[model samples]
Target: MSEKEQPRLASGLAQKVVDTIAPTIDRHVNIMNAHGIIIASSDAARIGTLHEGSVEAIRRNQIIRVAQADDTAGTQPGVNLPLILNERLCGAVGVTGAPHEVEPLADLIALTVQLLFTQEREHSRSARRAAEARDIISALLAGHVAADVIERTLDAHGLRAPLQLELWLPRSEQDPLLEQPALDGARTCWVGLFGAHWRLRKASDEPAADAPNANDRYLIGPAAEDAGELLAQAEAMRTLAGRPAMLPRRELEGIWNQDIAVAVARTPARSLKYLAARAQVLNQEQARTLLVVAAASSMSEAAESLHIHRNTLVQRLERIGQVTGADIRQAAESLRLQHAVYARIALDELQVF
Candidate 1:
């Protein structure tokens, strides 16, 4: 279908692509958001339901594929396309047509996806700039920076703080549903993929305690940091923390350092709360530390949290350093240690417990 003659899909191009496939392909085809919203589908019924695998890719940023049929015969089976542009996942388009039949369209899909994702990337870049500006203005407005100066700075920059801005998404994962739904609820633009998974990034200006609060939840924020930044931002503070319980050894191996899907939420006033919230948003380790770190304001604190002696705490801190790549020798150093572990866990946002 030509661009002008295409059907307007709820998902736009995904619908167009899927519709185009209808002329040649025999099986189902779908284009979906990272959230599993069927942007378009050859079969109309596929639209609103969640595409579990796609959602997981958005969450985990991992490439995933499920077998459409037995693959012992060297068949490629169905492929869940990760609509990625510039290495960041945008959304996904799927073809139920066998891989061989669908291969030809890959280039076309890739080209269009690149174009679309270029636009999406610009959105993320803009959001980052906006967030950084807001952080500066927020810092200034409380007398640390000053409101009058804030106006002058904005005037000079030809911009204003997106007074109510933030980004958030669900915890990263391979499951269609987040282990914690509150995470998705926290995002500004909800994204799901065709075959991967769903991801949501929270808006920039949400009141604390106002994001998706289902209790027993997970959240990270501030789009400035990608996967690497989650740990890099730690700098040395162990935020607040705990250990994995009843988790499998294999699952536990990589769970301690995975970056969870996060959103940017603003505090009501640019005060200590905002600073605190920003720390949580900007430093993913602190976010995870609140959930995964070994408790310790000092050697004494660590000892109490772990039910051990201060010396033992030091020994354990050394061990934690060896195990999780966190250097917990000082208060400032604990954050890095804390964040490394925080990013590795895969969350299922839908769990009740």
Candidate 2:
């Protein structure tokens, strides 16, 4: 709708707005839907009639409107103008004058529509984001869910992963950086555990805010390879917990043995947690402790599997005993620690199962 149709329109407003804007340009204004149904027009005949074929600009919400020099845009030499609200496209305005006349009007119309749509779109989008954010938190915080299922749920909501994951822990939600040009280059996701957030993209696309509290790992990949790769990454994510951090294709490959990859596929629910927590743990020492707990109910065998010399393993065992108050020398204690680490594969959430 035009500004003239606003709820609190001024007296003599419709005619006045038409008079003021029409003279400022040389083309007639036409407002149409995607189906070419003309809702309103400055030209009398076009008011109730359709534009013959589809009105593509309306469908795309694009500002610039065009037609061939001879196409049915009425007597215009060629249609060139814009349908806009305040520097944004809201509706189309066509100019019959030369390029000089048409060009400026196109820009002005785009500008006008942009302004008109800005507040409305933003308000609507904000409410939508708030609602979706609640849902995202629900996904992360509530219930027992399989890894593939959570991944699929995210996909259903348009979040796909193995997204080039990165953690962003912001000091404040009110940061000005959120609206900067740089933020326009990625998608965001949040994790409250580490106070982290992430930015994702397939290739390079405009950065969008995270769907909500579901942050920390952003998926950036080539668009076409996204789904399958995300699944593989999810499996990797499951297996890599407690390992030293390595970017993909680093020393990390050999570290992820075939068995670990298999373990990842089999352990869906724990996978996301494990990988995320693994990244957070960040050092071989901590990881080794977790792995030692994982390998055996006996510290002696855990040490053997880890290939550490027995005395050194004893010292390491002592360190873990000091930290967890559980003697790895005891099978029950060792087993409990192992289960805790393994169960916490995706540590960002509370996993009872």
Candidate 3:
């Protein structure tokens, strides 16, 4: 079989074995590929040379002992043991010492190398499965891949159709999910997005309610039926976050009172800019006062919400109108100002301004 088709010792892996074992054992360690070429050795100069002892060990599928230096071509006084993985001989590991002195060490080294190879194989398999999941999710979200084709691919990978999409956008660029995938167990597959965003595709067999607990660093998007809808939910959440008239105080907010604000945010860029222009001039204090007034049922409630006296709130309202040229007292102007504030916030969050 071709080397790729058969289990063989990779040069990097062989080198890692040598490096790891060399420190613990005082004797030199060497790892040779199936062809008996030294791939890794504690003696750096000996690498890439032939080791006849290792070659004999592999050919006989057993250990071979060299009694003295130069007893075999490119070999020293040592013991060489064949490294077997899955009952197949893949390589040999040799330890440099008297034949009887290093025989036990060579055996231990062979066992360690075999175990490490098995572990590496498992890791490679898991990575391959995760990559398959990512591809399936990408195709599913594209919404043009044929259903049967998706189903066949899912079966091939032992994955089910994704039931829901979960998204997370970092509060800052330094979030860890940008560099590593979140460990949500085996059933969920994660895909990373361009803006340090991450989305999870939970297989239909997994429980839908098992989401990560709320945290300060990430703004979680509402769960949706697919990635596309999940992304839309994320966009809506961002728009709501940007609204000066609304405070995103809750971890998950319903879309009940947010339809108009979302629609206004999706409007043409020029219209959004025009609406945002008036509200953008308002400073932080003015914006906070406006938010309370728009959310409260009455001016007294707005004052209480702001923790200020009603007369003090009236003064702030007057200042706000002067800055924005829009009255907050009248219902029509209040509604217009709310939309304008939403547009303004969305623009800044999206960096579209």
Q: How accurate is candidate 3 locally (lDDT)?
A: 0.65
Per-residue CA lDDT of model 1 for 59-174, tens digit only, reads 77654455566556432355556666555455666655456666456445646656664566456555654454444323332234444554455444433332222222333444
The sequence of per-residue lDDT tens digits that candidate 2 reaches over residues 1-353 is: 23464222121322233445666665665444334555545565765566532255455554343334544544444243325443333344444455554667656653554454565555655555445534543444333445566566556556554345333333367755444222222333333322333333334354434322322222222343444444454334333422212112222222223344334335556454644442342234655455644546666776666778778877776767776676756767655555444334334232211
Best by lDDT: 3
lDDT of each prediction vs. the true structure? 0.42, 0.44, 0.65
lDDT of 1 at 148: 58
lDDT tens string, model 3, 219-304?
A: 34434444445445555644444443332323423211366556775677778788777677777567657766766778898787
Candidate order by lDDT, highest to lowest?
A: 3, 2, 1
* Position 75, candidate 2: lDDT: 40
Off by over 4 Å in 2: 1-23, 26-28, 33-36, 40-48, 51-92, 95-134, 156-170, 178-187, 190-353
Identify the superior model by TM-score, candidate 2 or candidate 3.
3
RMSD of 1: 21.9
Clashing pairs in 3: none
Error of 1 at 299 (Å): 90
User: Between prediction 1 and prediction 2, which has the larger TM-score?
Assistant: 2
